[model samples]
Target: MELLCLLLYVTVNLACIEGYKWTRQNLPVLMDQNTQLLEQSLFREQVENMNVGQFEKLCGIECQTSLPPLNQSEQERILGYETMYDNGTRTHTDVRLRGLNTTESTSYVSSLTRTKRQVFGADGRFVISDLKFITNYPFATAVRLSTGCSGVLVSSKHVLTAAHCIHDGRYYLESVKYLKVGVLHLKSKRGKRRRQRAVSKINQQNMKKRPVFRWIRVKQTRIPQGWIHSKNSTTSLAADYDYALLELKRGVKQKKFMDIGVAPRTFQPARIHFSGYDDDKSLEGTQGGEKVVYRFCSVAKESKDLMYQHCDAQPGAAGAGVYVRLREDGGKGRWRRRVIGVFSGHRWVEVGGGEQRDFNVAVRITPAKYAQICHWIHKDPTQCKTV
Candidate 1:
């Protein structure tokens, strides 16, 4: 039953892309759907309660120093998206991202913002090279997008990812025609000594580049009209809706996909976590092709639509699921990890006075988005009536 609920939670629309009648009827049902997500906010509230003193210790001495005020501009923003069916149909709908008054402790927030460059210099990323751990729950949910990005499994046949991955709101990327999803399956090691030496030596060739995923053909892809560029709006605003869903040809047997969690736009947490495939250079040592890199950090800014952070990331990390681990409601301290946003990667934004400032952004899934995504995965509005 939980699995059924999860799949129902996974689907939604990206406008007219898939030829779905995402009419007014669908929107109202989704807008009025039951929100069983109260506990999700409860867990988020607990995370936001961490005080500046606690953060001071965790953030270390870097917070004690200050860096020049920053404004950013970058090309890695999630912009332009569309829904494409395997048979060659397309759709789109616009979602908006807006900021709200932040009430988080200013002091604690300052600590994290200050450390974005000061402390995280030279890359703080770690590789999940251990085959045993990488091919299991949580980590196993991470997958590689054919377009040189990364994504996470959300339902049996659906994957959640950045909208900008396959579409630019105008047309699909060149790779979209031959899109594929890669699943890194676990394999038996031939010799313990060889395995030990390979792992110790950090030799990906000796390891046979297991980073190569088990490839799966995509049945369809969906993105919001909001991500599509137009004369009426800018790409930066479209980024708020920079999310997409891909349906695979089949389900992954006996594998686990993550559940969705939602928090208020203004809410802030002590830490945010995510993992994805990146090139060899971003890692500590040479990693041959690509490796699943994981990192956690505090959010610098957040709004109704987007989240900004300074977590170390490089090319190919886009579309990775940004998740949080918190205790389940009434589970008596039992913890759960749920995906709350899709990493949008680096974005250089032109701010006031025509200055371009860059940010490592993620698109937070708002209730409206959750419902739309759920509708995409379930294909039935009734199943998507609750988060």
Candidate 2:
């Protein structure tokens, strides 16, 4: 009887330990979602009371040193100053894009062609991209979300993506079982050739050249309060604030990440490039063979919060980075690429009188949004001061 009692105690303890582990693993997601909802009223009250320091603390951000005030003209050009709700109520919050003080005042000219193949047409659908693996700029920066969304690495351990990809307006999606980021593992040349030979000789089921991916679990996720709205609220459909930032449990090694940048103040048609694991093109024999697909096109139009383009993309392409090349340090010849937007995917906007217009839209990374994202990435407002 004593032996049986000992075994029962051991079994109960083991079960308790397993349950604790499972709860601990999933606690962050539950806490984050509930915190955001419960803190909504308090956040609004604090913002209304102008308690900046307390507000920052509650939002999981450290208080930042005051930045140099922008001039009147600069303030006008920046976003968030004139942000309005669907009901025409303007937001009083001031969010500035960081890291823009170093950029030149003049607009940067783009060298891309104006006309390109339409990505939405029947012939343009499911088009395979020509981007080489691990040898390209944007391709190396793109990562796949376990939720079937695409994301871009903004920092070594942070990913920038669309908020809707992880959470709909009301609740988190079912596919977000656990936040994981998958990066492609490039194979050595010798290993690639050997695998090819093995594949030819071995049976299909026993092929040794299976694609490899390194998946890192996500530690935390943050979504803008603006993106969270009631189902009946018009702001729920607004795609302007559809961006999110994810903090990975660990850093990616040996892979390059893209720098986040602000969109140009003035509208200038420019070529934007993005890579993603589109679902339609994920099957074998498709373009890129289950690898990340790249696409580029000139900007069609720009609103205060969204950029419309015809980049060939499917459902799974949501949350991909929309990036452009710019002169680095205002140098005469040196150019650097930076991500300026988060792809929001196809959206239908109410035109008027029940008419809706469809367009492929990306949420522009305004200065205010940049500050918020940077805070999420670094957890310190001071570190994000420079963008």
Candidate 3:
């Protein structure tokens, strides 16, 4: 009788575990808009395979048979073409050839002058961040991409990042062999330090800490056509349209994700926050080790597609989510943080007369870009209308 009772208890526990696993696997998946469109097409060719006529037809620029005409707001949101044609009858094929040899004519020269008001120091503006654990709200949303870039979770399965990190204008970067997203695990620093110190004395059976990262493979990636440019295309290299969306093969329901918000056209000077895994700060012998670093600064300048700021950032900081705090709608008492831009790293621009100026730039999310990204997240165009 004793043996039978023990067997029954074990069977019930095993059944419960199996049921939980089944429920977890059946959770709904968030879909990307671009991926959905590509899947619906009859031909499975790469996007580059589409000719100018086909591209226009599919994009609803020519026949308007496939998709409806974009409203003024939507039109404003679309990242314009890389180059302009005199005849206005250009195609992607023409863009490929013509855009290759063109050069920017505008030039302005300026020095990297430091001001009391500017956050201009090499490492002053940025600091190593201690995010406690994966339970933190915004920190939990941060993810490290295998391509040596940082990205943020906008949905359970979608990651938003800079296009250049994955594709450098022409082809995908060599580092992007198999895209992967790494989410940091929750571990106490004091406990970790103790474990490291006792490593020589402790046997394998005594250690209980989990691995640092929970890595998930990426299923698909999407970037705007405007970001693909010829080698000599100056405007494209300005990093105006440097944004991309990644869809992971599995959803990360354990960690929270961030919401998207539009940056106001004009407002009082405000401080914006962003965090990323900066390479310089994450070196093996660095004091902080391989931890996420954070920075905040005031906007220096704003253009139609980009925002200039003085945030101190290194190469690996590209694709960090630029977010700001705002109150909830309808005068709700709760405050929320929403991502308004994507950090595109440092850029050198011609101010005028062949002179160059250096600034850290971010790709601002306009209403249209917000809508497009929302569509990517929900796979429903109607759901993105709120932005």
Per TM-score, the best of the predicted structures is 1
Candidate 1: worst 10 consecutive residues by lDDT?
37-46
TM-score of each: 0.65, 0.61, 0.62
Please report the candidate that would top lDDT against the real structure: 1
RMSD of each: 15.6, 19.2, 16.4
Give the per-residue lDDT of model 1 (tens digit) for 151-264.
Answer: 999887989998767765445676777789988886533567765665755464455534456889999887754565556543222455668899999888745789876643
Better of 1 and 2 by TM-score: 1
lDDT against true structure, model 2: 0.54
Ranking by lDDT: 1, 3, 2
Which ten residues in a row are the worst by lDDT in model 3?
A: 18-27
Model 3 residue runs over 4 Å out of place are 1-119, 125-135, 187-211, 230-238, 282-289, 330-332, 352-355
Q: How well is each residue in 1-387 modelled by candidate 3, as lDDT tens digits? A: 445434533432232221011000111112232211111111121232111121111111122122333343223223332211212122221111111111211111111221112225555433333333323566667778887779998988889998867765555554455668887675433456666777664453454443266789887776655565554433333344678888888888754678887765532376677877776733432233246666666777665456777887776677989987655543343556678899876655445355555678788876556655675678565565454
Residues 208-241, candidate 2: write the lDDT tens digits.
3334568998876666645655543332233466
Worst 10 residues of 2 by lDDT: 22-31
lDDT of each: 0.58, 0.54, 0.55
